[model samples]
Target: MDSSSSVKIVSKHFVKPKTIAEESKQPYYLSPWDYAMLSVHYIQKGILFHKPIHYSIDAFLEKLRESLAITLVHFYPLAGRLSTIKTEIPKSFSVFVDCNNSPGARFIYATSDLCVEDIVNPTHVPLIVHSFFDHHRAVNHDGHTMSLLSVQVTELVDGIFIGVSMNHALGDGTSFWNFFNSFSVIFQAQEINKNDDLCLKNPPVLKRYIPEGYGPLFSLPYSHPDEFIRSYESPILKERIFSFSSETIRNLKAKVNQVCGTTSISSFQSLTAVIWRCITRARRLPLEQETSCRLAADNRLRMHPPLHRDYFGNCISALRTAAKAGELLENDIGFAAMKLHQVIAEQTSEKVSQMIDQWLKSPFIYHIDRLFEPMSVMMGSSPRFNKYGCEFGMGKAVTLRSGYAHKFDGKVSAYPGREGGGSIDMEVCLVPEFMDALESDEEFMSLVSF
Candidate 1:
């Protein structure tokens, strides 16, 4: 975790440990549907490596155990009724293949002598996860590509990294973040309590197999023309954190509003337009390419009888729109602002939100492919910043971000509470060339205003 330590601590080793569940005296035929009932989701496991100087790994682990116990109380099954819902992790999870089987889902599996307290300088905690995959993932495919889920802790001041790989079917960002924050409270020694009214009576039994009728509302005629092919082909994925003063962005917003009509636009939308122009120009793709961006809209309001912060499950929806990148760039910034606001407001509805959930329940399951596509660079706003405050009492988080998810051409994550007022820490991951170009170009850099 420290700069002083050698960076080569990630031992080139692959290990997977497995044990089958003890044969119960009684056997039960749980339906395959039952497995879907439980919290397929995991509490995200990230590390806080302390400098090991004068601090024993044993001591740190003990603190971890205490934290774990506190977190476990808040851990509950997802809102559903499936026999295996609360099923303990399966033997099939890591056995017969590759996965370190990281202990406690978060811990320091030391590869070297240097510990956290000794770390005068430390890298991001998530880097550790990357190092493992780069070095440890089995080249020989052994049926378990879902191997990254078993988060492990390894020590080697080489550099600390935090990793969080959740089950895809887990709660939506709203619910998942709620779980993350709840778990974080244990570190703060705070209590994690469910909403008093959140009684789990008559949970939804809708099978994920059948996508319900959100049709007509969700269905749009997609007749593609040859030249205007809406082909999204490319393995685009990477993210990097970029900072901007809130004052600058606010001024940009005001100027944009004055130029455009009274239509409200967010700072995220304005920035997205600027980046869209840059990317369109850089790729040398169609100047008038119908570049579409999807806003990741939260749908806590979409459910019947209404769900609140604690109602976990995919409660997020997307609102997508398109414009000629060339035209967007030519107009004042406010034009793009109106574009973003219009697209988002249109999407902000129970009709669309339910449509998404219903679509998930449909027999025609093509949406999995859609998740990887870049969706407005994913601006996650209003997540509690208490995770950053978690200090081993060593120091505060200098910088934090939602790291690169290797599935988009580029994506951005906005975390709350920057040093300046009303500014969110924005992490932008794009093609390496774009990063280079952004660094070099005055005009593009000015648009981002970092």
Candidate 2:
């Protein structure tokens, strides 16, 4: 089958570790952030490798399975299943994971006649590339499907695509990347006759401690993950991927600073401001309509004494900035960028700590419905994630994509361009009319490569 057809599964099985660490064979508690995500699995992500390997398909699958199993020995929570607390007591309603005898992650081997060139075609049909991933295993839930990690490796004409579907409740982007890097390290060690005793580059720390007063706050009922699933299925949506050159980004930063009469402005502030403006303009919201730019900020270092880089689970806070549609459209890019900068400035480590403290008093509920409402956009992922570093004995990935971008509307996923250095890629999903307007946007098109 080609890119347009369903991915045919050649083989599928679980990849359990040959032996589990004695310390890991116990229940792992979910942090407040993690428990908050147990109701949804919106954090699925994937990367594509375009390098050709000399090994046969069977050999490649075997190597990957073996390395992943070894990697799971260190990052074992992913091998387990989430167990909701079963009691009428308010405090007992929280969820935790039973790590003992976990069935392990799912690994699937598949193939397609689709060429790399066709998969990246600018004029390709919408959602055609999503066939490269097994979406149901990531977002859908059933009695039989409990694995937190699901991987599908498809052999393309010229290269291979490794798609990872991770449950948000299991961990955040940091944990996901940590597991991937550990897997790569093990795979590389096995590939070459290197020392097998190489310590885990970033060993996971899984002890979860809930701040005092966190339990009583989450007692309120909120929308279910199933409702999110229903609202996220937008057949009328269109997803577009664009690459911004490092030079263009630099130019944008300089332009914003010059216009704003300021000396300092981050690339994120400038670029995201530009895209936010374009998306707002494309939507053509009325002047009085309010718009919000919600950017996911990693809070790993936001608390005093900072969470370790290897601290597993969700440690993100969405910093939002709101403005009137007319003001956003009428003002120059610098104004919007300055507003973004102010938002970032307001989220200091103290502020984040305060937010966490307040969260224990009243847990935050993620409202997926807000994304579908008019004039709002949620931005996620980052250039700082460095997906290219996920080398599994193969060379760096030729490109990276989530593949399942059609699952939501008005969502933007950003990543560092594989071209190296400061280049960036913005994967945007919007309703068809707004996408059309964004495509026809002269200013936006001038700065971006389709």
Candidate 3:
């Protein structure tokens, strides 16, 4: 069967919170960090699970919808819509969440004839996977009219895929997973006791974090979203997951430390170093051309009066480390690893605050053209997130996959392996030519487990 054509939408609707008081309907201001992500696309990710033995699609949908409504009560901003306000004093516009007249979160139920293997066994991830997510290609700023959060449950022949697309302005990976974890917990709890009142172990802190003396609302530099937001079509790309066993990671870490004469190098840094080196070689860029790697650093713990772990918003900044192509390729893996380590180590609390303060002063929005520079690689997501731990009574997720949003050549996402114990699954996206060369590069594939 044609997988794309076989997939059909069963139902689609907005899922509102179970209970929200009128007094609590105040506007939730977007912070500088949140505003930085206004032009970026939604954070699209999905979890694939084996079909439960006694699974009934109808029953599962009912339970999922019910649990989501309860989850929305705590993550109320997600159920709200984005609103733009004009101020005459400075003649600027500010964006905030309108909690009073929320249209609720979008929920979709779909069905497909494909099986689990059709998704996982491919050498290159099929484009059909992108179909699983709603609000395809919509940027975060589109939340003004579109739903801020969308959930699509696609029932496969022998599996289930739960696709979640959250506006990047709403939260980061940490916040997104926190909401997913909470939703799963409530879903599982209801299975055991439907009448009991469920509670989140670590409920989200809704208050926006702003530096002292800064306005809670930051004015947009542009007069209209159209000034920054634009349609972007990436070059044809091939995505593949490169699995690194725990032992292989350990070896890489040891090699980097031994060569650099420093024991502080982490596994993630070491692994990313190898990826940088190999991809540079594959692209075969001019020796003098500059290349950089962008790492998404979480600022939750790096803040002055550190925000709560459950802070429900974007608290991430991209730390870029650049080197010439010749320098990166000619040096040992330890050199690249050390470069990453130093950049990450330098993001102290003061540094994070300074980054935010500078952004507030400039108020620049990220455009698609500015995001993907030449010879640049961006590493997003993290192996440390509890990707495999989100269980909604159908057992843990078999694997996690990302949708087409924010995908560009050299975009890499890291996830913990299904078997767990320190292993990592790197979901790598590169142009067709680069992907072909990287797959054949023995030096890089030597450590990758098939």
Candidate 4:
């Protein structure tokens, strides 16, 4: 069969909670951090199961649906929808989740002739992999209580691919992973015995109140979503995955240490520095132009009374550092690596508290649109997420992939390679012009296995 016609959607439906949760009627308030993600609707994650498994498609679907239903009971807020409310305290508009359980999470079952070997081992993943997902279910165009999570399971010739799209405002990457891991555990339990009353090992804490250290930041004035809600659109956008072996990473770290005359930096820091420097050079911006690297710093553990690892909300803050284009290009990788370390280190609990306190005092939420330009880069996701642990009775993921919407110029994502043992896969997006430069850059290509 031709690749385009190989995949077919068998069915689409919603997986409701097994039982109505007590908190189903309660409203879940959006935290200040959560509000920051209001402009972005959803995040898409995919995992490929390549190893042979014994279960049939029918059995696997039953396990996934049953487990997902139970998981939704614990993560009940995900079964809700987003709403704009008028608060009496400040007489202002606020964004809140109406846990009305109006519509359950969407689930799709699909079949494909595509082999896992063709998709999992490729350095440049084809964009068609996105077709396996019901991508439209994620965006709430009508702005009503709909599904906050959408999942698609595509059976391949050799394995299965599970694609998940979760509302960005509902939670961060940590929350998403927690839900997936919990769901996997339930699935595993079901696989062992047909009838099992499984409970989440780490049930989510869905309290709407922001912890005290986060300060008295209540609802701010709501603005027109169009201001910060613009989707990335470019005429010549392209995305490709670049693999870096453990040996390459070790060599890069050693080079960074040698340049800095110190061995304190981590592989993440070194690799990020190398990528940033190479990108800056590829852009070939003016010497005086400013270039910045933006990333998210998880603040769940940085707070005074640290939040539980299972805190089900956005417990992260944005971190940015900038240097002149000339300086970022001229400086060695270690210099950039040191700067990255310093910026991350500065996100201490005390510092985060002060930052939130300052934001609270402001009368309105500031909307800073990150323009996608050659001179700027924004990093998404991280290498530390437990991508390999999402085993749903079949086997651990052989490889991982992200959504196509991330294919905007200046956007990047990093994930653990399926090969494991400190390997990293970098998914990069750029305009054709800069992408050509990046591909031809000898130093960058030397480190990546293409």
Best by lDDT: 3
- Clashes per candidate (backbone, < 3 Å): 30, 0, 0, 0
* Per-residue lDDT of candidate 2, residues 1-450 (tens digit): 343555578988887765677866666776667655544443556666775657577888888888888787777777877654434443324456667756788898888777666567655233555666654534322212567777788888887888887777767777777777777788888888644455786788776645665542233233333432332344567777888999898888899999999977888789899898999999989988999898888887766767887888888877889899999999999888998899887888888778777766676545455433556777788888758888886788877767563245578878888786788888888878898999899889999965
Give one digit per residue, the lDDT tens place, for model 4 in 82-193.
Answer: 7775555555556777767367888899888788877866545666677766654234322354567888999888888998888877788889888888888778877787
lDDT of 1 by residue, 278-303 (tens): 65555554556656665666655644
Worst 10 residues of 3 by lDDT: 1-10
Off by over 4 Å in 2: 1-4, 51-53, 89-92, 124-126, 135-144, 194-196, 212-232, 371-373
Candidate 4 local lDDT, residue 424: 91
Instruction: Write down the RMSD of all candidates, one decimal each.
Output: 9.9, 3.0, 1.5, 3.1
Cα lDDT, all candidates: 0.42, 0.73, 0.89, 0.75
Please identify which of the two predictions, 1 or 4, would achieve the higher lDDT against the true structure. 4
Residue 290 error, candidate 4, Å: 1.6
> How far is 210's C-alpha from truth in model 4 (Å)?
1.2
Q: Give the per-residue lDDT of model 3 (tens digit) for 55-103.
A: 7888989999999999988888999899998765666778999977777
Model 4 worst lDDT window (10 residues): 363-372
TM-score for each prediction? 0.64, 0.91, 0.97, 0.89
Backbone clash tally (model 1): 30
Off by over 4 Å in 4: 1-3, 51-55, 87-91, 121-123, 137-145, 209-218, 223-235, 363-374
* Model 3: residues with Cα > 4 Å off, grouped in runs: 1-5, 21-23, 87-90
